[model samples]
Target: MITYVYLVCKSLSLLFSSSALDTSIITYDQTHLKTPRFPLTDLELASLYENWLVGHGKTYNAAGEKERRFEIFKDNLRFIEEHNSVNRSYKVGLNRFADLTNEEYRSMFLSGTMKRVKLNRMPGRNNSNRYVVRVGETLPKRVDWRERGAVNSVKDQGQCGKSICVFMCLFVSFIFLLVEGINQIVTGNLVSLSEQELVDCDRSWNKGCNGGNVDYGFRFIINNGGIDTEKDYPYRGVDGTCDQNRRNRRVVSIDGYEDVPANDENSLKKAVANQPVSVAIESSGRDFQLYQSGVFTGSCGTSLDHAVVVVGYGSENGIDYWIVRNSWGPNWGEK
Candidate 1:
């Protein structure tokens, strides 16, 4: 039950949206967080909870006793929440879990894997940076004196009868409120994106993942020391010479090949129409290659002068690849 609640709270935003809710978007800057920003109906929250966990890796475990397991799992969830929100240095205490019944949720707090841990040394900086000074010292407070505690207060320690659930609900609710407030204050419009779009936005924001050369168009924006072809061939220029010249740089993508001779066999356009928007067409060297593989992993063309994400994918000659979307114009590269 605790696991269900945790999952529900996490997945609620994925299931449904009002126009206001749908418009909510989470940007991926390191300073920006990615939590649901709106309230969800019970059913919508439940559906998202069930599907996302199943999709990710928190499935039911079969190795442990049914009754003893959920408590441990719930403890794990509590630990993670506390670690992220309250305890910084604490490693996540629970990973493995078994399927549990509702009775397990009620009766499983027995063998005590769930106790509040008072951390002496805080791990990293919390969202805030002001340090409390003592007398004339300039250093921040020592870990031993920082005085942080879990949500469980004194009255909570000796509680009984639905007390645990009440505390659990309160803790989760507080996190929801905090995250939503942060989202409303900092995140941009997300309603314009569907699930797949959200995923793409995240990928694009990954700094290390931009592994290919920058196209001349993109280079204009980031060509710090002019073109370093050895390290910068695979990328497309974004805010470069063209933009400065008051001309829209020619954008190259599978979308512009309307008059090009398509094999009618494997085509990038077909890939996009079929798969999730996460698939895309990528350019290989000066040539074109289809990048139809699904999200997370797919092959870009070899010896790639530049690499771009395929927002969609399909097949040609039974060869599967992606339909890459690039910032470069139609005249920039191959069809």
Candidate 2:
């Protein structure tokens, strides 16, 4: 009877425990229990990737402009933080911008505030009109709204007159921002090329105040991976890496000049392929040039002993600098 009573008590205890568990516990389906991966648009993903490499609180110059520190846009901050590798020791670098082309950037920019406008020549009686060229929806583009003036008829002007007028009024400020963005893209904010500095380089005989530095200023980055180099005149490298036309060939190490135009036909074009352009403070007699004869295009710099392409150029505080292109990934240099 005692044993039977003990068994009854144990059964009661067991029943009570089961009842308590059922009341306190909550059940979730597999679909509900699993955490869903956050979906980021391409822009968000790119920004996140850039932030992860550039740094959480880092700031960069917008081209070569001063008095401005471009902040890392916050389109996808939270999502980036989740995927950022905690084990990595280095930050994202600016080099990623070097290999990026204007077309590729345009795709990203299209997602942002890029705008297009039609322009024409003023009927100089000798020159004709040019078609529509998309302008970035930003200050600099608006500021220097008339840099390469392409005239339009009153009717063709459409409703953009008021907006165009506004941009024309703020040309200087917009130019400064444009240069700043270019500089940021080039040097990764490690260096800045200021407007004043560019002017100084243009005016001074020694360029960078005798430093032998010439500013290329900021330009719109263009993408060109799809084009066949050999088939194309300007872009003639095997992988469309560099221009081919003798006239369009980039002048590597303008042996004795500064601010040489990319399309300068007078400039000696390199006939050889894969020639690296070298940076020399004094135009050192080094064979390795920083810019390749037909390997790549765009502004770049290099040392006599070590030649590298000037993927980007900018100015800072009345000084100019170059953004060298490298094959390394984001963590390797400027992100």
Candidate 3:
């Protein structure tokens, strides 16, 4: 069963017209570019058996299930090969989402229920502060919190619609480490914060395993003093009893978080230059779903249905982009 709801909104401003002229090309080292390997036709049969045995290709003992998965894998491979065949600004390939159809893929993987809260804007303030690049204020061409050792490995949210919880956990955890200084992260003393604790325990205004706002989650952290590490309150995906014993394992507290003024890409860049920042952007487009690697100058909409983290920003082949860290898992993008 597959379902989809097409959202009609403003087209992404990423794909630039010839009239737009401020962007510069940014290049990456060839060695760092990851080209995903898809299953070859010659080895498909053998790979299918291996995958089935490992509980991947099939579920029920029903006939034709294996064949269905194989066909799906071939479709995925064809999509990748076709997209990469010609030179493009970005690359696309088979990841964990390879086998699912567009509808199934969106339903299972991109189910973050983001509430559209209208932010109150102050009168006369431009949507954002004017862009002023300070003297000697150059940022790195690229920055990944994972490389800085402040971010944990990419986490799979599974079938749970709790991406809000996951992003909240990632945001708070990384910010805590950033405030504690790089020494703790370098010394391996930083703890992986618990998303499950937020899932099960954050009852102020959040629904466990359903979805919630990041601001509410942050307020929960502030009122509760802190949140537990992943070791103390492991992720169960589904809602569970909030373990009171694990509450004492809190390691960091959130004072508060400020929202970047709406549609302010410049402010977003500066915020990310300092630390990873949680962001919600429209990701229901097929182009976003198939994103494999490189800077994603999107064909995305402005509906803002999903939450992601902006780890850095840079240009690729004259297109400026945000280096987004997704929660779909390490297999989904450049990990």
Candidate 4:
């Protein structure tokens, strides 16, 4: 059965939203994530491609396009098989994104804000530079806000270039959680905020479906008085004009946001130990596209291209991982 996750609640307001992880579209054998691999013949390749298409419930509009996608799928299959044939910590498998070329994949899924970024002082941003961890303090071995019922749900950006499901999709959900977490810390109430509100109205810098800056989103919230609830605005996965009435129904609000020191894992851990933090990472590698499971300490690049949330952190048999709240939907990860 397939389940749809509408988390961009439309996609991103600052960062790129998930374009594939319907996480409705999950696959790869349980064995695939941690099992052995072997070579496949031409006949095997043809058969596998057919099965993948059927299983994913996919159809191309034209025969030529289908053929093109098949070739792309074949190339991706070779990469997955080659990587998995080796004994490695992580494995790759055929997911919904298999037919897409890397360039096509990045264009559709990765937000532009994550690329070619030039950092500057964000106007009206909170100026605090430190997370304030005491000298004697030590982080716990693991922290998972999902286990503690702090996370809301997984989201899928579909084909969104960004999320409220417009330009940058993941931030639509992450920022919602970030503020919700903070609100819970203060009011002890959990409310789902509307990502659509940001998508439609925050046009000063955000591009809706083209991508936008993540940092600018917080200030937009403060200046707008507050944000609306998801029920109030709802996600449409496409661009729409801002609704004047619903746009003003601010259900949740924040005082301001602070930035974490760059290249500082300790400070990051300290922050994650306390609450879910918005973050970006380089997710352009083909391996990242087909990742099945196991800690994703990857073969990806340093070029930041995607945005996600660090809800918590933990260590497992010496392997440490951040509990990332990706907008790829529930089916994509640890459901």
TM for every model, in the order presented, reads 0.16, 0.17, 0.70, 0.81
Native-referenced Cα lDDT, model 4: 0.64
After aligning candidate 4 to the native by TM-score, how far in Å is the CA of 205 from where it should be? 3.0
- Show model 1 residue runs off by greater than 4 Å: 1-305, 333-335
Model number with the top lDDT: 4
For candidate 4, the 10 contiguous residues with the lowest summed lDDT are 6-15
Per-residue lDDT over 111-193 for candidate 4, one digit per residue giving the tens place of the 0 to 100 score? 64355334356555654656756689787776666566666754567745333353456666667778877777667777778
- 199-295: candidate 2 lDDT, tens digit per residue: 2222222222221221222111111111111122321101112222322322111111122223221120120011112221211111111111111
Candidate 1, residue 289: how far the Cα is off, in Å = 11
Best by TM-score: 4
Better of 2 and 3 by TM-score: 3
Compared to the true structure, candidate 3 yields what TM-score?
0.70
Query: Which pairs in model 3 have colliding backbones?
Result: 25-318
Every candidate's lDDT: 0.23, 0.21, 0.53, 0.64
> Tens digit of lDDT per residue, candidate 1, span 1-335?
01100000110100010111111111112222133423445554444344434532454456664335444434433433343343211122111211223234324321122332232232321222122223554321111100121111111111223423332322222222222222223442111111111111222321111211112112222222121211112222121121221121212111100111133322323322322111112222110111111111222322212222222332333333332332222211122
- Using lDDT as the yardstick, the better of models 1 and 3 is 3
lDDT of 3: 0.53
